[model samples]
Target: MSDARAPASVEVEGLTFHYPGAEDPALREVAFRVRPGERLGLLGPNGAGKSTMMRIACGYLPVPRRRGTKVRVAGLDVATQSLAVREQVGYLPEQVPLYQELRVREHLEFRAAVKRVRRRARRAEVERVAGLAGLEDMLETPIGRLSRGYRQRVGIADALLGSPPLVVLDEPTVGLDPNQVQGIRTMLKNLGGAQTLIFSSHILAEVEALCDRIIILSRGAVVADETVSAALASDTLSIEWGRPSSGGGGEGDAIRGAAVQACLEQAWSRFDAAGPLEVELSVVGDRVQATVVSGPVALDELAAAIGAESLAAGLPLVRLEPGRRRLEERFAVVTGFREAPERAKGGRS
Candidate 1:
């Protein structure tokens, strides 16, 4: 059991690692802390070191000698107390490794024994996990004969054997059918708050659903770390307006542009008296688009203010949407797949 006074569930400080012959380090100065019972999502594109970090957290990989590189699980230093750390964490890797010939019950029993459950309590432990993983009906089935989803369940059952305080899953629902995915997601939701969970998946929706906090990695470096709500909220407002027809009695491009600029300036002066806002206006053919970039603020209020100002300025309000970047869009920008014009212009505050 861990000391009662420990302040964190999992801690990694200045963690850096390199494969034996690789050209670059697999992880670089990674650092974060998982509060007890917090469901954290570890996100990254392929080759972003999610697997490497997971292994290190579960004490499967050795801690490098780099200064300040440390990993502690349940108040025990993973480097010095590897066995205890392993006992404190239940791990389900991306690949579900199981004995092909063993029955589901037999495999779980074997895992319980390996995890050092008392001989007399092993049966109860196996049955408990089997029920939790929805494997009670399949206990008699051979591992080799089960579908991919069932095999994954067997792996989860094994991990849950000793009721570890921390559960780390790597792509737990990678290739399951929709039903199977839903089942697994439901199981994970039930596990929330009962144990601290850290899982990695390319499915953003799944991550968003199961995790309270998110850590995004790009090329082995921690890029963005924030709560899901904050990540999804935008710090910019993008407003678009349609230019009046220029044929006979409508306003021309110059007039439309000036109207938009004046409206945006007035809105900024009213709402952003602190003067941290960057407003950009452009006339594109028959439309005018204005982007207002500022520090984190109430987006709805900003939109309302912009709408009222546009109305006062006689500008057509075609679209008044949150200009804040989406999590997916930001992920792409950070991972080097694409560039964001707002980012380049220091628009992200």
Candidate 2:
């Protein structure tokens, strides 16, 4: 990093925000802190307050301070010292804000000047960021002439100017082709441990692949905050009991129900059933298969329990597999995608 200081930390306490004349606040008593050098991903469906939280963190939105409400970025109050906060925080919104007329080098030089990069070192700073974003070859290309991928790279390079302590990217890979997305993803992966990076994305795999920690927002509330490991070990699993003991009709039916009941018993023993576990069982000619959906069931522990129980019952285990990551389910559950009748939108999304 060009700045000769530790990466900046972000702190928000009891923050609530409302757009002009909005009936409900965009955010509600939301609170969290990001440590220096942490890569945090903010996740939510559309209008779930993810973007609002990002704006507040980057000092683009103002917070009305109640007794416990405030937002601090890089040790500066976002409301009181927005300019200073902006100096230390580099932000790229959902739309890549660019002047298409300018050449890449010219645009970056202007950005460096705006960020107060030293006059003598400005050229070197621009070159440094350009290299980091793999734009050294396109320095003289006019931004308007560049492909969408190159344009996104230019935006990234611009954000890296002066090596700001915190870098925020919103949907940075949106609308890119596969190769372009991979390029950007690789560049972002190389940026960790040097700066405080926070971004918002609807892509579960992207967030899972990039972030060390994740915070999920739903309906203007912070619903889940967990490390990547914990978040991905969701409660869904696929379990296969040994092939039905040479049968096809009523025998297979009885065996399927019995095996799934055993699975439920094992799941319930691990933790209290948050309502009955959702189970889908099938008895094929060869094996009895079940897909179990519950809440926060650890894969290893549950698998071990089932294996032991199945062994004692003279039933061999065919396979035990983890279903989708917990983050996806939480995303669906809180965003109301799991329900037919979704909640009405009342907040300023």
Candidate 3:
């Protein structure tokens, strides 16, 4: 189920595959497009062929030699021009194979040579990549002795040896501390606007933070492909308020929600609205719990109108902030993690 619904940067058509000695095809009629300069996160549970697809993209695994079309990388035909396609793409596999005995500088040089970096600027090129990857300090350190983060950086440096337009990173941050993860994410975010990057990870949060869009694959097919903001924006709202205590709970304090709702209703009278907006409000100690539909009305205006009136009536005002119905919550809703009868929708809980 590819998103034939939108324009594509990379396109695949009628893709089918079966691994040697495997019982079934790893991929089946998979078709999707990754837009140019877009960071698309590939997500799936174990054994869903995410790695297989990445391998195909990198030319490690050959597409089935059949009459029908299959896969392509960077608009180059994978079936007929895989070699040329690979040259235009950079791949960092899960293991990040490197020569442990070689120093960081040496490993990069070796990779540069293998990638056919020109002789005239090889030295400067490795130095430049080392600086970009934050490998300057450890350039003289042996690859085997470096931490997981540093080793990953070395791998990335190698992949970026030629500054290819497309870079595929397979779980580049699989095992690293929080700081290291943030560092990598920051680096990638800084690099995103200039180059197209495709990264695979099981961590949805990482995808949420780094990728502009996400694609969830299940059973070798795309189940979701949407902009990261669109995905998160669907179920969340941005709310603003001041400290409740400052509003001075007046006589009308008890009817704050009702009053606010009424004010919104009055303001919305110009147009035939969609019934009432869905909102979840609660109070835990001093913090107000709110889940309101995001709209054009600025928080300052809503807060001023509601808070001023509420304060005059004896309620508190507080600052406003954006709130999210977390990614896991959205995932559960879409995937039906919890099941109930149709009547469940009618019962308020």
Q: What is candidate 3's lDDT per residue for 1-349, written digit by digit as tens?
A: 1111121146777777798898877876777777777888887666667888888877888878776666777677877888877776778898999999999999988888777788776788899878877788999999999988889889888877877767888997877678778877887777575667888887788888889887766667666667777667532243433434443354434455454454444433333543444455644443444544424454345444544554554444454444544455444444445542121121121
The model with the greater TM-score, 2 or 3, is: 2
Off by over 4 Å in 2: 1-4, 241-288, 292-302, 313-318, 340-349
**lDDT, residue 108, model 2:** 95
Error of 2 at 53 (Å): 2.4
| lDDT, candidate 1, at 107 | 91
Q: What is the C-alpha RMSD of each candidate to the true structure, in Å?
A: 5.7, 6.3, 6.5
Judged by TM-score, which candidate is best? 2
Q: Give a tens-digit lDDT track for model 2, residues 1-349.
A: 2555578999999988889999998999899999899999999878989888988888788778688998998789998998888989888887898889999999999999998888899999899989877789999999999988788888888888988889999888876788777877887877788889998888888988899999888888898887888776655677787654654567667866576577557645766654445666667656777766544566567667767767766566788877654467656766677842222211111
**Model 2 residue pairs with clashes:** none
In the range 105-205, model 1's lDDT, one tens digit per residue, is: 89998988888887888898899889877788999999999988889888888877777888999988876788878888888877777788899988888
Cα-based lDDT at residue 162, candidate 3: 72
Whole-model Cα lDDT of every candidate shown, in order: 0.81, 0.79, 0.68
Cα deviation of 59 in candidate 3 (Å)? Answer: 1.1
List the candidate 3 regions with Cα displacement exceeding 4 Å.
1-9, 66-68, 235-251, 264-277, 283-289, 293-323, 331-349
Score candidate 3 by lDDT. 0.68
Q: What is the lDDT, from 0 to 100, of the residue 238 in candidate 2? A: 79
As a TM-score, model 3 comes out at: 0.78
